[model samples]
Target: MQKYILFTVLSAIFIVFVGMGIIVPILPIYAAELGATGFALGVIVAAFALSGGLLQPFVGSFSDRHGKKGFLITGLLIFGLTGYTYTLASSVGHMVLIRTLHGAGSAMIVPIAMAYMTEISAGKNVGRYMGMLNIAIFSGIGAGPVLGGFFLDLWGRNSAFYTMALLSFLAAALVALVLPGRDSLTIEEEQGSMLSVFARMLHHRKVMGILLARMATMIIMVPTFAFLPLLMTRHMTASGTEIGMVIASRTIVNALFQMPFGSLADRYNKNRLLLLGSTIISIGIFSVPFAVSFVTLLLLFALIGLGEAISWPAMGALAAEEGHLYGQGSMMGVFNTAMNTGIFVGAMGVGALVDVLGIAWAFYLVAGFLFSSAIIAAAMIRPRKKTCISTGDKS
Candidate 1:
């Protein structure tokens, strides 16, 4: 059961992200062509984050009582179908609506996948399993931009969208055909209303600390993925392919380091790792505006990736530990909500900063926010005694 669940979930997520990735390098440029200003771009990104964040806790809690496979399939199908709608968007409003729908699909997928994985993993090795999951995620994302860029440079912008649609559909099909049904996999646990679960979590200091730290760290995503191409265009000459390569550099490095760092997370102090990792990320983001050449930007992004690699698995393990008490689906749902909230805040904040000051200020401001979060995390998160959960030995 563990082997089957791991393989199916990882494979599905990889394909879905690859489809998602193909658009990251070009989506902002596409939006701009439709007459979107900096703030308009932020609106589009925030719309997705907001819609997705709102749905996660409910979907997660419901999945805990019901079954996960159905929601997973439905979400993947929604995700695949939404990719085609992007090509039909004629105005920024249209784009925002489509992205909102996309976020709904997102609300169903990754968090549920994390919940499934946590359920089947031995408690002592949560970080190691999470590391494996991250490798699939980072690897797909790392490969995606390059392919998107290639399609854009060779065929046209629309080609990338069409390819994304195809890949997403394939992923949905993969999950439906291979993963076991609800009865085979669902683990019954005591679960309450989503709101009740959320209320309890809000009062739990360690969980709040983890959620805040996750949100703060993720705030850099908007500037890094959505605005980096704009920054590159202003600073120096860059092609679509070059922009894709720079983005890929970070995720690829992150994928490469997930295992070793995951092992460290299992053995060492997770909070210290979080601090060390966030500090590194802050330094990398702060240096972004200074990068004048492609190589320089690539190296800086790679440094950020390394920081994430060290921190991400540790964070995942902590969340999984908490999942043992709160229920995995419910815990991951709220966890991912914090992630979306960070991205939404970053999108709005950075977009306004770019319009008011310049693109460079966005990077500077996010770096400062992340550094501040590291301090708060240090104060709130403490080392916990390890406990192991058994994975039933079943085929």
Candidate 2:
């Protein structure tokens, strides 16, 4: 990737993820303050994921038929605008609506940005490049909560929203200025229907497997963000700032570990790394309920973060390798949709479970799911003795 393009992708990812992370520690409290019940809070959180999930296929198809840059620009603009509107919300209903809009932007941006990255990066270095992209994600996730917590303490929750908005706008501006010009398609191609693209994507087996795994991982992950704060507060008497610190710690560890894990995936069997990651995640989830102090929670969160670091880049590299059979845009779109749907379901299910069954059981259930996913990943992933034929290069 060109230095400028890499910078643009990183900046855009940082902006979107930071905006998301800022809300993670305080969103449930914000919903409760707005008079939402547990179910309502679940709905509010799910609304964003649902909207983003639904839009992915359409946005991706449009980008494939049209060009990447237009969708990239449009998506970033929408993200920035809707992100600002969160400050204006007065109730959970309004928050849900705004979050849905934000999800729409998410659906457009992620797949296309990844596709653009794939197009620009050399096949030999794709895993490393994707790891760098994930580094951007973890950086945003790591820093946002710490900064948000500080702002929440000093200024207020509203200040966090404004800060997110400002960062998003700056990112959009950077993308507008630095990204290469939009690719052109002939008139005949421009007239092609998006449904045709969707139909084509559905039949790709490699894409389907990667998407399923991506979805499963997200389902395992989202619940941690959704319920961990409440769990910490209830069990350990953690304040908001301390909760943010724990969250940031996870991201910090994730960022620190991703590049090494990505390099490992390149050298060894990506599937093996994936299995190891899943096992770590399972262990971490199981440990969460046993955390009796902030220090314990931090340690468990670090384990979870390490698991995430191993899984994400390997998944991306695998998806990218598989995607060569289809188009990169289509595969990424499907993957993003599955992932977002998992997030939506996981967040809502965990919240509801907490209300009905209890928080401890919810953590156990999520842990079971993670372990099950690990087993499935082990059974399904068969590493080729030779490097992938499509890339024509050894890791």
Q: Considering every candidate listed, which one attains the maximal lDDT?
A: 1
lDDT of each residue in 275-314, candidate 2, tens digit only:
7787888788888888889998889889889998998888
Name the TM-score of candidate 2: 0.91
Candidate 1 lDDT, 50-114, residue by residue in tens: 99899998888888888788899889888878888998999999999999999999999989888
Candidate 1 whole-model C-alpha lDDT, 0 to 1: 0.87
Kindly report which residue stretches of model 2 are placed more than 4 angstroms away from their true locations once superposed: 183-197, 383-395
Q: What is the TM-score of each candidate against the true structure?
A: 0.95, 0.91
